[model samples]
Target: MAKKWFLAANKKQTDGNRMEAPQRINASDGINTSASLETLPHVLFADDDANMREYVSCLLKTQYRVTVVQNGIMALELAKTTRPDLILSDIIMPGMDGIQLLQALRQDPRTHDIPLILLSIRASEASKIDSFDAGADDYLVKPFTPPELLARIKAHITLKRTRNQAYQAIKSSEELLQSVFNGVPSSIAVYKTCYAADNSIDDFEMFLLNDLMCQSLNRPKHDIIGKRYRELFPTASKLDVLDLFKEVVYTGQSTSFERWYETNGKNRCLRFKANKLHDLLIVIADDMTAEKQLQIKNEQMKAKQLEMEARQQREIFRVTLRTQEEERRRISENLHNGLGQMLFSIKLNLDTIDLSDSLFSTEENRKKLKNAELLLANCIRESRRISHELMPSILEDFGLEAAIENICSQLTGPCNFVAEIEPIVPPADQEIQLAVYRIVQELALNIVKHSQATEASIKIYDSNEGFINATVSDNGIGFDIQKEDNNATGLLTIKHRVKMLRGNIHCSSQIGIGTAIKISLPKTIDTY
Candidate 1:
C-alpha cells in the first residue's frame, strides 16, 4: 500500500512537471539554485524506493538543500562527509537499515549530534521504540503529509542551530574566563576533591592554576596540574591545611587564614582564602608582606617618638624643679640672715632690760614697757607668718595629710573648708607630695579669692590603682568654662604642675551651680 501511495505522489508530481532526480540536489546541479538556497539547511534522505525519493525531493527542494541516497549505507556516508543539519531515513533498506545507520551515526563523534528522523512502513509501537532506542531524534510513518515532513525538518534544523549557537557561546565564555583567571593580580588555584571509600574528602588534586599561582609555586602548570596536593607539597600535611580544604568542600563554606610563608629563602606574609564551588575548591592567595612590614615600621617609629617626647618632658620637669628649689633657697636665706638677725637683736635688747626694775615701777612707765613688749611680740609673729606663707614648714615636719589639714585650718575668711585626706602609705615621693600640696594650695586660694562661695571642701585619697586623686569643690557662683578668662592664673598654675607630674585634671562648673576640680596623678613617675 505504501508503494502504491508513493506511485500516486510521483504521478501527481509528474502531472505538475515538478518531478526531481533521485540523486543529490545542490547549487551545482544546474537547476539555477540561488545562493539563498545554498545557505538553506541541508537535509539527507535515504530510501530504497526511487519514486518515494523523487517525491520527497520534489517536496523539500523548494525549502531545503536535499540530498537523496539509495540506501542507509549511502546516506550514512553522505551524512558523515557533508555533515548535514538533519537526516531522514527509511527503516527497510538494502544494505544498512535505518536503525543501524542511526546507531552508526550516533556512535561516530563527528555525526553523533546531527538530528535524525526515522521513517518506516511499520507504525507499531515496537518499531517506534526501536528507532528511538537507536538514538533517532524523531520517528514517522511512511505515508506522512508533505506539510508534516517540512515542519519536522524545519523544527529539527532550528533546534540544532540553537544548540550549536549555545555551544559556541559556552566555548567563548570558557575562553574568556580562562583569560581573566590568568590575568588576575592575585594568585588563584582550583582543586578537585578526591574522596575516600567512606565518602569522605581525603585529599585534593590540582585542577586549575592561574599564572600568578604558577609563579608563586615556582613551577609550571603542566608540572602541577592533576598532581595530588600532598605529592606537590609534602609540608602541607604537617601544617594540617588539608583539613581546612576538606572543611570547605564538606561544609560548602568559605574560610581564610594568614601566615608567614618562606619561599626562595625570603620570608613573606601570605593570606589564603578558600571557597567551595560544587566539588571543587578555589583558593586565592595574596601577599601581605609589604603591608605587614610597613605596619611594623610605623609601630617602631611611633614608639620612638613617644619615648623622645617623654624624655623631653622629664627634662623640662627637672629644670623647673631645680629653678623652684633655687628660689626657695633664696627666700629661706633672706628670712634667716636678714629677718632672723633683726629679731635676735630685738630679743637681746629686751632680755637685757629688766622689766620689774624698769622706771622704778611707775604705772605709766610699766604700761609703756608692756605696750612695747606687745608690739615686739606682734612684729615677731608677723615675721614668722610671712616665712610660713612663703614655704609651709609644717608640710615638711608633718605628713601630707596633716599638712593639708593645717592648710584647711588656716581658711580664715568667710568661706568654710573641709579636708578628706587618706594617710599616704610608704609616703609618696617628695616631688609628688610637694606637687599635690601646691595644687591643693593654689585651688584653695582660687576658691577663697574668686569663687564667692560660702562652703568648700577638699578631698585627697589613693585611688588604689596606682594613682593619687584630689578633688576640690565649692558651693560658689560658677562661671562659663568656655571663657578663656575664667581659667584663672591659679588654675593655669595648677594645670602646669599637673602636666609636669603626668596627671589629669578636670574642672566642671555652671553659672548658677558650684565649681568642682578633680586631679589625678600617677603614684610612680617614670623619669626616663
Candidate 2:
C-alpha cells in the first residue's frame, strides 16, 4: 500500500496538466475507528495524497471528529467556516502549500487563534524552521506513530481551551471594573504620565474618563480622551495641577486638596483626591461650589446680626441717659416754681408781724398772726411732699412690698385699682429692688394715663426660682402694641430697665379690649 501511494505521487507530477488519483487508506488494516462516545474536539487534516488523508483520519477518528481535505486550499476554507479546535496539514500539497496556508490563517483574525500543526516528509532543519516561521504551533515528521499523533493533538487542543477560558475571564473582569468606575457619583478619571527628555513628568494624557468626569468638564468623552491636560483646560498651568499629580506619582502616596476654577463664567470649587495606580494616576473630584457659597453666606449673616445688636444696645443706653436728665429737669422746675414761691409768701407774712407783738392785741391783728402761722405750716408740708416724691424713701426704709402697696393706694381716679402684693423678703441687691419698683411704676402710670380703663390690677410676687414677677392689667381702651412706636420714651425706659436687670418683659394689648404688661426680674444681678 505504501509503494502504491508513492507511485501515484510520481505519476501526478508527470501528468503536468491533469492530476492523478490519490491512494486511500482503509480501516480494514486492523484499526478500530469507531465514533467517539462524547462530543469530540474538531480537527482539520490537509494532504495532497488521498491515502495520507484517509490514514490520518482513521487514526484520529476514535478520539476526535476529523475532517479530511485534499489540499491546503480546502483545509483553509474548512478551518474558517467550522472554526475547528485544531488543524493538521502536510507541508507539501498540490495547491497552496501548508506554509502559505499557516501564514494566511495567522493573518486572519477569525482563524488565527486556532492551534495548527504541520506534517512533513522532509525532516531537514530548514524545513522545520520554515514551518515555525510560518506560524505553525507544532510539527511532526512523516512515518510518525498514531500514539505520537494522538498525544500532540490532545496537548494542543487542551492548551487552546485553557487559553480561551483565561481570555474570557480577563474580559469579564475588565467589564466589571469599567462598570464600577462609571457607577460612582463623583467624577473619576485615569491619566497616563508623559515624561520630558530629562525623565521628569512634564504632562498627563487622559486615558479614561467616566460619565461624571465628562459631564463636569462639560465636554464629550471623545473630545477629552487622549488629550493632554493643557489641551483640555488652557488654564491648567496656572492651577499647578501637573505638579500635584507628579508629587503623588513620585512618592507613590495619595493626596487630597481643594481647587477653584472658573467655567462658563461661573466660579467653581472642586475637592480632589489623587493616588498612583502603577503606571497611571487616578483622580476623584467632588463639586464643592454650593457648599462653599453657603458657608460664605452664613458668615455674612452672622456679622450683620452682630452689628445690629451692638447698635441697638448703644441706642438703648443713649435713650436711658436722656430720660433721666429730663426727669431731673422737671423736678427742678417744680421745686423752684411751687415750693420756692410759697416760702417767699411765708417770709413776707413773718416780716410784716411785730417782733414782740402781744397776743390778741387786736382782733384783726390776732387773725393776721393765725393766718401767717398757717402759711408757715403749709410751706413746711409742701417741702416734705416734694422731697418724698423725688426719691420715695418708703422704698429704702420699708422694702419693695411696702413701697408697691403705698403707690397702689395713691391711684385715685375713675378706675378701680386693685393690688395683689405677695409678702416676701426684699431683694438683697438695691439695684434689683429699684428696678422692680421702677418697672411697676412705669406700667401703672401707662395704664392710668393712656388706658382709660374702669378696672386695673397690679400683681407682685416672688417665684420659687429666685425671680420677681410683676404684672399689671387694665380693662381699658387698649392700643395695638405692634403699631405703637417702640421708641416712645415711656416704653423705651421700661425696656431699658428690663434689659439692665437681664430680665424679660411682655406687653399684650388689643384696641378697645384690655392691656396686660408682664415683667420678670432676677433677685440678684451678676456683677461680672
Candidate 3:
C-alpha cells in the first residue's frame, strides 16, 4: 500500500493538450533529442526507483536534454564518454549508489569538475555529510518540491558554465602574452641568482632568453640559456651590466642605463632596463645606436654655432672700444682748434683794452670790447656743444623723449628732422636709457651725413608686444644695408649699442628708395 507519486511535467502543452515525452539516451547512440532541444545542456540522472527517474526526467526535460540511467554504474560509464553538464543521483540503492559514483567522478580527471547533486530518502545529517565528503556538490532529500530541485540544478549549471568560460579566457590571454613576449623587438632575458656556499651571490644563471636576445647576442638559444652571465660575457664587469643586475636583486630597486656594446667589430649603444622579480632578475635591452649618433651630431653642430656667435660678439666689442677712442680724439681736436683760438684772441683784446691807455679812442675801445665779448660768447657755445655731444644734458634732465626732441631741434643739416616720440615711463636702468638715446642719435646723424635727403623722421613708442620700438627713415637715395652696414662705423656703433640692450635692429633700404632703421627693445630687462 505505498503511495503512487508523480509530478506534473513542465513542458509546453501541445495542440492536443498533452506533454511531450522525455528524451532518452544510450551510450552508443547518445541522446535522441529533437532539433529544438539540441542546443540545451545535457543532464544525467541515476536512481534505482523507476517512479523517481520518470518524475525527474519529465521535470527537467523542458529546460535540459535529460538522460536517465538505472544506477551510478550506468551514470559513471556514460559520464566518462558523453561528459554531461550536470549529474543527479539517489544516494541509497542496491549497489553502486550516488556516493560511490561521486567518488569515482571526483577521481577521474575528465569528470572531476562536473557539478553533481545527491538525493536520499533518509534526511539524516549523517547522510548529508557523507554525500558531501564523497564530493557531491549539492544534496537533496527525497519528497522535495519541484521548484527547489529546479532552482538548485539551474544555479549549479550556470556556475559551471561561467567557470569554463573564465578558464578559456585566461588560457587565450596567456597564449597572447607568450606570443608578444617572444615577438617583441626589444631583447629580453631572465636570470636566477646563484649563491655560493657562504650564501652570498656568486653569479646569475640564465633562466629565460627570448628570441631577440639570442639574435642580439649573435648566439643560439642552446648556447645562451642555462649559461652563467660571466661565462657568456667575460667582460661583463667592464660593461657594469653584471653589477647593475646584482644591485637590483639585493635592493629590489629597478635600474636603467645605456652602454656601448661591441659586437662583430662594431660598437653600438644599447639601453638596458633591469627589474627584480622575487629571486630572479629581468632585463630588457634596446638598440639605441642610431639615436645616440644623431644626438651627438646635433650637439656638435650646436657647439659650432655657439662658437661662431661668440667670435662675432668679440669683434663687435673690439670695434666698440676703437670707436670710443676715435670719438675722444675728435672731441680733443675740436676743443683745441675752435675754443683755444677764440680764448687766445679774447685775452689779447682784454690786455689792450686797459682804461689807462690814452691812445685808445672811446668808439674804438667800445668796438674792440664788443669784439672780445663776441669771441668769449663763441668759446662758451663750443664748450657746451662738446659737453652735449658726450652725454646730452637734456636726456639726463628730461628722459628719452625730451632728449630725442632736443637732437631733432639741433639738426643743422639740409635734412629736416621730425620727431614723433611717445611719452613712456623711463626704464629703471639708466644705462638702458642711454643705449636707446645713442641708437636714435646714431641713426639720425647717419641720415643727415650719408642720406642726401630733404626730409627725415624719427618715431618712438612703447609697443603692445612688450617692447620699446624706435624707427628712423629718410626720403633720400639709400644704399645696400648688407654692404654698407658692415662698413659704416656709425652703423656698427648702433649695432653694438642695440646688442648691449638685448634689442633687435632691422634696416631696409633699396638703391633708389629711402632707408628705414627700426629697433625693438624688450620692456622686461631679462627677456634677452
Candidate 4:
C-alpha cells in the first residue's frame, strides 16, 4: 500500500481560531515585498497525484511562491504565461510527461531559460538519462527531503537570473552602437583585408556598411556586404582605390585625399579619409561635387564681368575722342574765316592809302605808312598759323604721311626736326587717322619745347602685323619720364590720343642721353 500524504491548509480550529494560509505574492505587481519575500523565487509544480501535488506545493510555498498543475501539459502552459523562475514536473503522467514538457519548453525562446527540475517515482538510470537529455536542469527522486529540493531550486534560479542580466547589458550596448552608426551623415564603410598567396594584401572584403554608404553607392545592404571592393565597383580597379586601403592597413596611419568618379552619367567629387583598425580598414567619404561646381561658376562670372567693364571703358573713350575732334574743327573754322578775313581787310584798307601821294609827301609820313603795312602783314600771318595749329587741314586732305612732312618742314626751332614717313594709305576710319596725327603732333611739340636737342627724327611705317608703327627720337637733354609731373599736359595728351586709337605707347628717356617714343596702332578696329 502507498503511504497517504498529508499537508497543511487554511482551516478553522475548534476554539474558533483561524489558521493562516501562506502569503501569495504576485511578482508582476511590482510591489516592494519584504527582503524575505523578495528572496522567494516563483516556482511551478506539476504531478498526476493530487496528494503529492498538495504535499510538495505546501512545503515549497514556505520558501517560494508555488503554482500547482495536474499534469505536464498544464505545467508547460502555465510556465509560458507566468515565465516562472523555475519549473518542477513529474516524470510520468497521463499525457505530455516530464521529458516531453522539458523538450517543448526548451524549444521556445520565452521559456527556454527557465530552470527545470524533473521529479518521479521511477528512479531508474534510463528515466534519469531521458530527463537530462530532454534539457532538464536538475532531476530528483520521489519522496525527497524538502531541504534538498529547496537547495537545488535556489542554485539553478540564481544561475538563470545571472545569465539574463548579462544578456540585457549586451543588448543595451548594441542598441547604443547602432544609434551612433546611423546618426553620422557621411558615408562610412568597414572592410576586412584579404591577402594574396605571397602574404601581400591584395584586396578587401566588405564587413559593414552604414545606411549612408548604401545610398551613396545606390545599392542595397545585401548586395554590398560581403562583397569584394573590386567586385562591387569594377571601375575602382582602374582608379587603384584598393591601394589606399592597403596603405592604411600596412602603415597603421590614416590618410585623406580628394577623388573624382563618374557614376550614373554624372561626375562626383568626393573627399575621403581612410584609417586602419588592425586587419580592418574604415573609410569615411563626403561628396564635394556641388561645392567645386559652385566655385567654378563664380570664377566664370567674375571673368565675364571684367570683360564687360573693359568694353564700357572703350566705348566712353570713343565718345570723348569724337567730341574733342568736333570742338577742334569749330575753333579752326572760326580762326580761319572770321579772324583771318578781318585781318586781311585791315591790311587791304591800309594798302589803299598812298603814302607817296601828295597830301603829305613827307619822309615821316612815308615811314609811318611803311610801319603800318608791316604791322598788318604780321597780324595776318599770326591768324593763319593759329588756325592751322588748331586743326591741320593738310592731315585730312593729304593724309598722315603728307601732314607729317609738312609739319617737319615748318619747324622754326634750333632742333633739326626730320620726318621719315611711310606712304601707306591713311586708316579708313577718319577718327583713327586724326588720333595718330594728333599724337605725333604733341610728341614733336614736346621735343621742341622741353628737349633742347639739336636733332630730332620721326618715322612712321607699316608693321607686318596689321599695325602702323611710329617712333620719335631726339638727341637732347632728356628728362626723367617717370618723375614727370601731371602738369605735363603735352605728354599726357599724346598718351590719351594713342589710347583712343586702341594703340600702345612706350617712352624711354634718360638725363644727358636721348628720348625715344614708340607707338603701335592696329590697322582695323573691332566695332562689335
Candidate with top TM-score is 2
Per residue, candidate 1 scores C-alpha lDDT tens digits across 333-446 of 767775666666566655555557546645655555676576578667767777686777888888788878887889846989999988656567776887888888878987
Reference-based TM-score of each model: 0.45, 0.64, 0.58, 0.41
* Residues 1-528, model 2: lDDT tens digits: 434645554565478624323233345653334443236788999888887877677667766778999888988898889999999998888879999899999999999999999988789999899888888999998766556788899999999999999999987886787789889999998999999999999888998878888888889889999999888777768887778989999999999999888876778898999999997999998999999999889999989999987897888888778888877887777777877776777677666766455654455566667887787787788777777676779999998878888778787578877889886565547878787787788778777888889899889888767778899999998877776584462887787778767788898888888988888888777631
Q: After superposition, how far is residue 100 of candidate 3 from its true place, in Å?
A: 43
Per-candidate Cα RMSD to the true structure, in Å, reads 15.5, 8.0, 13.8, 19.2
Tens-digit per-residue lDDT, 67-145, candidate 4: 8998888888898898999998887888888888999999999898889999877888998887788888998987566
lDDT of 3: 0.83
Residues 95-190, candidate 3, lDDT per residue (tens digit)? 798888999999999999999999877889998888888788999987667778989999999999999999999878756765777998898888
Query: TM-score rank, highest first?
Result: 2, 3, 1, 4
The CA lDDT of each predicted structure is 0.82, 0.81, 0.83, 0.78
Residue-level lDDT for 211 in candidate 4: 82
Better of 2 and 3 by lDDT: 3
lDDT of 1 at 442: 75
